[model samples]
Target: MKKNVFFFLLLVSYMAVAQDTTVKKLQAESGRVIQKDPKDTLPKIWRIGGLYNLNLAQGSLRNWAAGGDEFSLTITSILSLFAFYQKDRHSWDNTLDFNFGFLRTTSLGSRKNDDRFDIVSKYGYAISSKWNLSGLFNFRTQFFKGYTYSTNVKTFASAFLSPANILISPGFDYRPNSDLSIFISPVTARWVIVKNDSISAKGFYGVDPGEHSKFELGAFLTANYLKDINKVLTYKGRLDIFSNYRHNPQNVDLFFSNIFSVKLSNVLSASWNLDFIYDDDTRLFGDNGTSPALQVKSLVGVGLLVKFGQGRER
Candidate 1:
């Protein structure tokens, strides 16, 4: 895995050098020098934008005959940001996503509803109108400590970077359009990192007892898509599949996520996010917490919608 990562990085470096050489040769044919125009108002080649969502709800029961909570509150926030660049044959894109939710009531007071942090970066060189040579780097983790509640006890589950996932791959991407991309990789490297000692000892997310990290060499494929169903509705989704060549290759790992949005007005919108995952190495689900099972999560909110930027959404 280390050797493959090294070679992939080296190949990218060589490609950059070759591109630089071509640029120099092209400049040699021109003798006139152009000065930067102070009055030029052209847009930059790179486009940056982000969307922020904040949803809040509160309920109060006054003189309630039926049994009910006196006060209840729910708050959820999600932030997504992206920067994309396309110049000549080279393109680079980066994105960050964060989410957190809080819930409070008279019975279950102030429990965390959700938490996650994820980032992705990819670079591609166009090989054709519909194909590109690409490399991807992705990292996913959570922001806060997580807990599993029982009848009377709460068990510690995870913390920031306690069980983060990192993936690196060199692949070919087929772009049918600006809104969709499918990447295929025969070689992929993935790492599961457990930063907390206590968590590592417990071996929650595929790491062995007392081990800090686990490495895997595998094949990975990912697809990203975005579509506008209409003027007021939009959808985004991603799919990932991987198979470890060394251990249990027949049992593939999968991750799928979907996001849907409906615009009600300029400042108000409804959104829903659904995520599902299944890993051969993770056996933390089911009634015994020792058998592998599908994990699912979803969040629905109606809140403020704020978007900034010009070009595409990824």
Candidate 2:
């Protein structure tokens, strides 16, 4: 079944490319093709930009009538970046993002609050004005160890590369404009890698006992959106859905993320992030330990926003 699906995808891709070539040929023969002006400056082919935010909170009480921690400190930092290349019918897009945070208090000692790292890359060849033959690559993991405390006992939960997820997909991309893209693929491959022996031995994240990786074949769909609501407000989001044919296809996985930001000044901004995820194979969060549950995360922060490198303006 996998071989047949791949063969069909290849056939479709070939036909689309051939049809595009024919259309271009006919247009040129009929003198309908618009000619490029030699005097016009070349469009910039590379775009790079990113944003960074840091948050800090601290409190110290020498002697207070009210009860409070003697000393407390909290810090969080985030980095989001993107780079893209575009010329003629070919385009490439890439992004890398990181989020890490921790908090310390005299009463509770120290605890991690957030941790994440992810990267994505996609390349496309235009098949029409709004459609492209595209391939996408994405990888996500964490940077620091995660733990849960029960009855003052620290328990290991996750770590760097302990639950790394990697995806490779080839399919059709529908991009109507600079701010929206919808990709669909019938043949998507994903590998969940666990480098930690302790995590792997327990079959965490769907890996078999004592195994380092698990493979999945699926149909995947992802939609990305970005919009500037006005001079001060902006919104961006992404939604990813996958159906695993090798396992229970009906029990699909879903992940969604959204960011809303408002500019306060030239260097200051406020932003909020919200994420939701669900995977049938992730049974640890369920009450029965055999089912799946929705997981949600959210954070709000106010900090600096920096922009560099030119991107074709949206």
Candidate 3:
């Protein structure tokens, strides 16, 4: 698993570097001076530097096993990092995010684990300074390395699979300021045509219930906010909501997460994360429909957010 992750990261880094060189070459040779008059006062073309964060989650949010609450004494942890880069005035926004984690049950001295790799690309057309129309494309996979016992047999498989979690959504965004933004995607279509395994585990959020991999309809909404106080403190928050009704085992889920940061320098920061998850489908986890389940998790993390690229235009 570690080797694959290393190779994937190396490949992505190479691709990003190669693409930038191509873009530079094209701009240099194209006789079209894509710049405006010097006195007219339009900002120069420059690429936006990317932003990154590394997180360590603690408490109940750390458990990634099949059942919930039964592992309260468990100590689970998840590590997530993200980056984004785009050109000013460029109508498209691109993003790449990765999450990895494991779970350990202290009460029973048992351990279980899984991880996910997600890459999302979005294209947007600015409606104004505060609004935009966009489309999102996502590619996700579950990296599972553990034991599965069935049919009087036990086998261990270390592999990655993503059954029918692939879909495209057309959405809209509203950004009131640099600190807050909202996105809505309604009447979106989703289909999970095939998966490499029999029983489909949880969906992308790790909070959603299990369901059949087939055609599904849903809506998506996300809210994001960020604030900085002086050079020492900052806060960021995110909310994700998703629902699908047309597929087997109907479900609705809401997930809220926040991060508080203390800057030690221009390039280094310390962070703490809080996460909460709530869902309406108890049957998704094969429950008897007796009560609702909520998952809460927190973490303390420290990492570097490196911005590698030319600064953006004002």
Q: Candidate 2 regions off by >4 Å?
A: 1-40, 149-153, 286-291, 312-314
Best by TM-score: 1
Q: Give the TM-score of candidate 2.
A: 0.82
TM-scores for candidates 1 onward, in order: 0.84, 0.82, 0.57
lDDT of 3 at 134: 79
The best candidate in terms of lDDT: 1
Per-residue alpha-carbon lDDT of candidate 1 for residues 160-184, written as tens digits (9 for 90 to 100): 9887999999999999987899999
Please state the error at residue 63 of candidate 3 in Å.
30
Candidate 2 local distance difference test against the native:
0.86
Residue 13's lDDT within candidate 2 is 100
- As for TM-score, the candidate ahead, 1 or 2, is 1
The C-alpha lDDT values of all candidates are 0.89, 0.86, 0.58
- Candidate 2 residue pairs that clash: none
lDDT of 3 by residue, 9-116 (tens): 999999999999999998888966678677896554334444565443334535566654433332223333333433453455454445444554544344354344
Worst 10 residues of 3 by lDDT: 281-290
